[model samples]
Target chain A: MFDKAYSGKRLDRDDALALFNSDDLFGMGKAASFIAENLHGKKVYYTRNRHINPTNVCVNRCKFCAFSRSAGEDGAYAMTIGEILARLAATSSPFSELHIVGGLHPDWPFSYYLDMISEIKKAYPRIQIKAFTAVEIDHFTKLSGLGLRGTLSELKSRGLDMLPGGGAEIFDSNVRGRLCPEKIPAARWLEVHEAAHTLGIKTNATMLYGHIETYEDRVDHLMALRALQERTGGFQAFIPLSYQPISGAIDVTRYPSGIDDLKTMAVSRLVLDNFPHIKAYWIMLGEKICQTALYFGATDIDGTVVEEKIAHSAGASSAEMLTTGEMINLITKAQKEPVERNATYEEVSI
Target chain B: MRLALHPERVVTFIVDRNINYTNVCVNKCSFCAFYKDEGDEEAYIIDEGVLMEKIRETISLGGTQILMQGGLHPALDLSYYTSMLQKIKKEFTINVHGFSPPEIAYMAAKAGLTVRDTLAALKDAGLDSIPGGGAEILSDRVRSAISPRKINTAAWLQVMREAHLLGMRTTATMMFGTIETPEDIAAHLEAVWRLQAETGGFTAFIPWTFQPGGSPLGRTAGHATAADYLRVLALCRLYLDNVDNIQASWVTQGIKTAQVALRFGANDFGSTMIEENVVKAAGVAFMVTKNDIINAIRSSGFKPAQRDTFYNVLNYF
Candidate 1:
C-alpha cells in the first residue's frame, strides 16, 4: 500500500531497513546520489533579499531554539514598521523581496503586522513583501478571531507579497510535544500554511532535524511535505533547519548527535526531489559550509542579511549585516554566477 | 526526507549573488575544488575593478557582504592583502569576511610577521572577521592525508589562537567523517577546547563532512552518513563545551538532516547563504530561499532569528 502510495516505485521495507542499518557510509551515499540523479538533474536556484525577524520575544521557547527571548531581553525586541523600513533603506540594495518572520508575540495585534507590510509597500512600492509564517498567521487568527484565509487574504490585499515559510518544526506530534509544548501542533501549522496556499499565496516548506526525532520521523516529515506539495504545488522551496541545542532546551552535554549538520543537507537534496530549491542557510550553518554546500544539493541560499537577530541571540556565526560584495564572492567561488531574485522568484536586475 | 512545511514561525531570507575576489592561492588544500591554478581558465584572480563590478551588481540586488578569499601567494604579501581589503572596505561598507588561516599563516610567514601581526594588518584594512576554513579536521593525521602542503594542525590552532588572542573572534570548523575516527573528532574538539578556554575566541563550531566530488577524494572516497554527520555535529556541541553555537551543515547534509540536527545540538539554523560553490565541485546540491529557512525553523517549533558574524541580533519580527 505504501509502495503504491508513493507510486509503484517504493523501496521495499526490507530495502529501506537495510539502507538505514547499513554501516557502509559510501554505500548509502551512492544510493542517495543515484536516487537524486534519477529524480532530479543537478539544477538549483537562489534569491537575493533579506531575512526580517519581526520579533524575538516569544512564548514558545522550544528545546532547539537559541533565538527566542522572554518578552524583553537585553538583545531582544520587536521591530516596528518604521525600524524595519529604516533598516531596509540603509541597504539601498535593489532587493526585490523582503523575507519576514517573527516570534509569537503575545501583545501586538494582528493588524499591526499587516500594517508593517502595507507600510513597506508604501515606502518601497516595488519591493515584494514575503512575510509571516503559519505560526504567525495562526497567532493572527487567534488574536483577531479570523480564519486563516481571511487573515491571509487581508494581508495579501494590503501588500503582503507572499508567505515566508516558517513554523513547521516536525510533523510528528510526539516530537512536537517534546520539543515545544508552547507551539501550535504540527497539524495546525500545516493547516494554516495550506489555508494560505489555497488563498493563492505561494509558500515554502521546512523540517528540523537531528534532535530527538528518529529516521522514520525524518522520512515522515519529507513525506508529509511531499504529500502537501503534490496537492497544492504551492511550495516554492524546502529548507532543513538543524536543531540548535545550545542555550536552548536540549543540552548538548546530554545529547549531541542531534545536530546532524551534514546528513541533513545531503538527505534533504536527495529526498525532497519534488521541491525546487533546498536552502543551506549560512546563518545557522555558517558561511563557508553553506558555500561548500552548493554542490551537496543546496542550490539556493537566503540573501545578504543586512541585519539578523534571533539566530545571534542563540549564537549563530556570520555577519549581522552582510553587504553586496560578500554575496557575490560566495557565489563566484562556488563557480556559479549569482542572479538577483524578487519575491515570487522573479529575477530582478533593475 | 520530510513533507512540505506549513511555513509558520521561523525566520528565513532570499538567494542571489556571488562574488569571489581572487583564487590565486599559495596554499592548496586537498579538499578545495574552487581554487585555480595561475593560468587555468578559471584561474584568473579577480582584481579590484572586476570585483567592484560584481559587488556593484550584487549591491544593486541587496547583497550584504563580499566573502573575499584568495591564495596565500608570496607576491600578495601584507600590502597586497591590506590594499585589497581596504579597497573593498573603502568603496563600500562591505563585510570583508575573507582569508583562511593557511592564507594568514602564509602571509605571516612571508612578511616576517606573526599571525597576530598579519591579522592586525587585515583588520586595520576593514576585514570584519576570519572564517574557520583551513582548520579542516583539527587532527594532523587527516591533515597529512589530505593536504600535506598546507599547515599542520598545530599551526592552524596557533593561527586561530593568535587571531583570538588579538581580540578578533572567529568561528571554529572541522571537516570530518573522512578517513578519520571518533577519537580523531574528539581530539579535534580537545584542541578547540584548549584554544577556546584561553581566548574564548570561537563564535560557533561548524562540523561538516567531506565531499568527494572532483577532488582527490573522488566519488569512491569515504563520506559520512547523515547519522554520522549528526553524531559529529551533536558531539561537537557536547564536547566543545567552550563553543556556544553549533550550526547544522546543510551545505553537506541537505535540509532534512539539518532539521534533524536541530534536535541533537544545533541551536542556530545557520546562514541564508545567498550563494556558494566550494562543495558543489565535490558533490552536494541543496538550496533554500530566505522564507524556506524561516518556515523550516518555525515548523520545527523554534523561533528563527537572522544573525550576523558578530553574533548580534538584528531585529525580532
Candidate 2:
C-alpha cells in the first residue's frame, strides 16, 4: 500500500507488482512525487555533459544495431583520440561531464579507452568522465583477457570514470536472447556493476521497456536492479529507457504513449527507493512528455546534452542540443527549481 | 514535480478554534441549521465570561487565532459587536479573525451606516481580519435560490472591498454542490480573482460542499463528489494564482481526502478547529487535533507547520 511506502518502509515484490497492476495511476504518481520531494526538495537535477560515442564500429551486430555497425560498413566511423579531444574543445559552452559510450570495437585495444580517458582528464581535469556501460566493460574484459575486476580497476586508475547505464535492455533471459543475443547476459551486467560499486564508483542504471517485454518482465528487471541497489547503494540514478522501434528487427509501429512513459518514470521512482534519482531522459521521452515527467516522480531530466548520437540514431525526436537556459526554462515551467549536477550527482554551483 | 507554482517547502495549518458567539438569527437561511429563532431557549448570545473562557482555552491549546462567526442576530447593534472585540483584545493577546462579510453588511444596514464605515469601526475595535463565510456563490440568482434573505452578491463583495481599503486581509470561500452551474462557479471565481487582483488582500481560497441532511432545506438531490471536489480544488489552484494559499476543507472532506488534497494544490490545512458547529449542524463533523493534523501532513510526506490567521507560520512540527 502507498501508506506503507509513505512511511519510508521498504517495498516488496508484491507491492511493486500491485502498484504496477493498480488502476489508481494518479494516486501512485502522487505517492512517488511525495517521496521524490522529500529526497530532493523542489529541485530537479540536470547535468551539462557531452555525449561522445568514440566509435560506432563493433565486432558483433545485434538485431537492435541502430547505433552500432560492422567493421566493413560504410557508415561505421571511429573517432581518433585527437578527433575526440578536438570535438570536446570545439564546443562553445563548457561542460562539467564527458559521457562516453560506444560500440564494442574488437580491433581497438582496451588501452585505447584508457588513453582516451586519461588524455581527456589530463587536458580537462575538471570534467568528470562518466564512460562505458557494463556490456562495454564486459567487452573490454574479454578483449584484454583479464578478469572483470582487474580490467575495471585498470580503467578506473587510468581516468575511466563512472558507468553510463546503457545496454541494460530488458533483463529477462528470453527477451535478452531474442533482442541482443550477442551482448552479455543480465548476470554479467549485474556483476560488472557490483564490481564497480565495490570500487566506490557510482553509476546509473537503465531498463529498455515498451517492446517485446511483459509487465512481469519489467517488474522482474526492476526488482533485480532494486536488489543490487539495496546491497551497494551505488546507483546514482535509474533511467527507464522507452524502446524506439527505429530499426528493422522490431515490429512495433507506435511509440509508447505519454501515459506509459509517465507511468514508467513513476513506477521506477516508487520501485527504486535506494536509487537517489530517477531521470526522464529527454532524448528518449521527447520534450513535452519529459516536462510532464517532473510531476510523475522524475527528479532529473538528464541534461543539456550538446551532442547525443545513440538515441538520435535510434529515432529520438528531441533536439540534438539544448542550451542550459532552455533546460532551466523547461524545468521552471514545470514548477521545479533546476539544479545543475555533475556525473556523480553533485550539485554544480556554477 | 513541483506541487505548487510557488513550491512552498512546508504545508501549513492554524491551531485555531471556531467560536460561534450567538445562534439567534434575524435572517433565516434555509440551508443553515445552527441558527435559532430569537425567542428560542437555545438562542443565547455568548456573554463576556464564556467568551473569555473560550479565549483562555484556545491560548492554553497553543492556538494563535480565534475564528469568531455567528448568525446575524436581530437585536445586537454595531456597538455590541465593537465592545465585544475591544474586550477580547484588552483581555487577550490573540488575533481576532471575526465576522464574515454577510454579518458586517447586516450590522452596517442595522446601524444605518455605509459598509466602509462599518468596517472602519470594526477595524478600530481590534478586528484583525475577516473570514469568507456565507459566500455560497457570487451570483445573485444562485444566492436567491439558496437563501433569499441572505445578502446578495454585491453586498458581500462591497464589504470585502471596503475592508481591504481599510488595510484588513481576508479569506474567500465558496459553498458549492447545491444548485449552481459551471458558469456560477466561474463567476464566483472571477469576482474573487478580480477583487484579489485589485486589492491583494485575499490570503486564501477555501471551497466546501453543501451538506443538506440537517438543513431546513432538506437533503439536496445532488452534491459535489470527492472527485468533483478535487477537480474544483485543482481548478481553484490554477485560477486563483494570485491567492497565496488554497485550503483543503478537511472539516467537510474528512482527513484522508484532505491529505490527498495536498497533491491537488492545497497548501494549507485550514485549521485544527478545536470546536466547529456550522458544518456539524449540517449533519457531518470531522474532528481533528493538532497532532492529527501534523501526522496527516507528515504521512503525506510534507513538513507540517503551524500558522496564524494572517498566513504567518508560527511553528514547524
Candidate 3:
C-alpha cells in the first residue's frame, strides 16, 4: 500500500480501507509525507484570517453541535452587518481572507444574507469572503425561492469567493441521521456543492470523525469527496475535523487520541489524491498535533484564527486564537517553510 | 538499519507490573501527575501485604519481574528500602527491577552514604536491576525548569555510574515533549551515549512523551503527537548506536504508534504494564494484555517474544 501510494497510483476504496486498518502508521505516514513533499516541497501554507460566526441561532439541532443555540437562548447571538464590520475594523493585523460561517437563521430573509456578504466585501474589498457551507446554501435556496445554482450564483455575485467546509460532517446516511437529523441529507449536501462547482465557485471539504464513525464510513466519506473532486476539481483543501466531546445528546466522554488524529490526516492525504491541500486545522487538532501533522502529509496548518467559536463551544481545549508570529514559529519549528496564502491558496506576500 | 541490527526480526516485551510503592514525593516535578504532598490524605506507602499480593498475581500471570518505582518520600530511609526488598526477595523468586537514579540519590543523601554504598546495599537486598524513571531530560537547564528539586544531570549520571560499578544493569529514559529544544534532546542523547560508552552498563534506551493531561505543567505543555514520538524514536536509534535496545512506549503513544515504532528503530515493545500509575495519573492510559502485545507485534510483521528484565528472550509467540 505504501509503494502504491508512493508510485502515485490512485487508491481504491478497498486500498484506503486497508490503509486505515493497517498498523504500519509510520510507513503510511512516510508515504503520505512523500506525496505531500512532492506536491509542495517543505512548504506549509497558513493564512492570517479571522473566523466570523455571525450567529449561533441555528435551526438544525445537531446532536454533536455545541455552538448552535435556539432563538432567545442566553448565549445566542446574531450580529448585524454594521457590528460585523466594526469587529473586523477593530483588528489591526492585515488579513487576506474573511472566513464567514454561521448557523441557518430561521427568520432572516435571503436578502439579509446577500447584504451581509456585499456589505463586508464593500468594506474590505481585497479580503476574500469564503462563506457558507453546502447546508447553508441549501437553506438559502429554500429561503430565496431559487435553485441551488441560482442561490450559489447570487451569493457569488454578492462577493462570496468560496465555501468553507462544515456541515459535511460524515456523508453516511445512518450516522448523519443520528448526528444531525434536521440538516440536509448527504445527497442534497453533495448536490449543493456540485452546483457551486458547476458555477465555478471553488470550495473546501471536511469530515467530522472519531465520533461513532467506522473506518468504512470514513473511507466512504473520503471516496465521496474524491469522486466529486474528480468530476469538478473544485475542492481547494480537505480538512478532517476531529470530534471534540461536549455535553450534548451525543454521549462522548473522550477526545480522539493523537494516533487517531495523525492517522486520519495521513489517510485523508492519501485518499484524496485530487485535493491540492490537506489542512491540520490547529484550532481543532491543537498546535503540537498540528505541527506534528506536517510530517504525516498535512500541507496546511490553517491560519491565525482570530477567534474560533464553533469548536470551542464543542469543548475544544486549544486556544481561541494564534498570532501570526506564533503560527510561523509553529511551522518553522516543525522544519517546514510557512507560506501565507489567501482563501484560494494563492501565495500572499507577507 | 533496524533490520540489520535486529537480524532476527523479533520484537520483545517484558511482562511486568509497575508497582508504585509510595506516592509521597518531595521533588514535586511539574511534569509528573503521580506525586502527592507528604501530608495529603491520598499519599501512601504500599502496605507489605498488598505489595506481596501484587507480586503473587504478577508471578501467576507469567511475569518475570516487578518494575517497582515510587516518589521520593521524605521519611523513608535506607533500611525502609532494604527491608522492603528483603521482604519481597524472601517471598518470591521474581527479579526486582526497582528504583531510579533520583530515588537512589535521595536515599544516599538521607542515609549519609555514598551513591556506591547505597547501590551496594540495595543490590545486597536483591535489587536485580534499575528501571529508568525520573530522567525526564538529561539537560540541567531542562531539569531545573521542570524538576529543580530532583537530581541534576551530573548527579543522575553519577548514580548510574555507581550502579554500573556495582555490576548492575540499568536502563536510561527520556520523557520529552515538555519545554525542550532540539539541542536539549541532543545533549540528553550525548549524555546517555557517553555513559554507555564509558561503562557499558546501560541495557536499553526508552524514550516516552510527557503526558500533560493531569500534570501541573499540562497547562503549558501539550501532549506529544504520534509523529513526534516516532521522529524522536528514530532519532534515538540513529544517535544512540552504542545502546543495544530501544523500547517503544505503548503507555503514552498507544499501541498503534508503538507498533509503527518497530520500523522507526524500536526493538523492544516495552512492558505489558498490567498496572501503570504514573502516566495514568496524567489521564492517559493504554492497557495491554500479553496477548495484545503479541498480536500487535505479529501484525506489524515481527515475531513477538517475552523477555526477562535483561532482554533475554524466554518465549516466542
For TM-score, the strongest prediction is: 3
Which 10-residue window in model 1 chain B sums to the lowest lDDT?
A: B1-10
TM-score of chain B taken alone, every candidate: 0.86, 0.94, 0.96
Q: Can you tell me the DockQ of model 3?
A: 0.13
For model 1, residues A1-350, the per-residue Cα lDDT tens digits are 22222342544334443443443333334444444444444433455577788788887788777777888677678888888888888876666678888888888997798788788888989877888888788888887777777888889888986877677878889988887888888788788878877888888887876667777877777777877887888888777875554545564432223124444555565556566677777776666556655545566677776667766766665567555566666666555567666667666675
Model 2 C-alpha lDDT per residue in residues A231-321, reported as the tens digit of each score: 9988999999977655546765434544566678888898888889999898887665677678789999887788988788887767898
Quality class of the docking in candidate 1, CAPRI style? incorrect
Runs of candidate 2 exceeding 4 Å displacement: B1-317
Judge the docking of candidate 3 as incorrect, acceptable, medium or high. Answer: incorrect
TM-score of each model, in listed order: 0.52, 0.55, 0.72
How well does model 3 score by local distance difference test? 0.87
lDDT of 1 at A247: 49
C-alpha positional error of residue A39 in candidate 3 after TM-score superposition, expressed in Å:
3.0
Residue-level lDDT tens digits of model 1 in B163-236 = 88777878888887567777888898999899889899898888888887777664445545554566577677
> Per-residue alpha-carbon lDDT of model 2 for B138-254, expressed as tens digits?
899988987898899988998889989899999999988778889999999999999999999999999988777788665653345555677788888889988988998888876
What is the overall TM-score of model 1 with all chains considered together?
Answer: 0.52
Per-residue C-alpha lDDT of model 3 across residues A170-281, encoded as one tens digit per residue: 9999999888899998888788888889898999999999888889999999999999999999999999998874534596533455667788999999989999999999
Q: Grade the docking of candidate 2.
A: incorrect
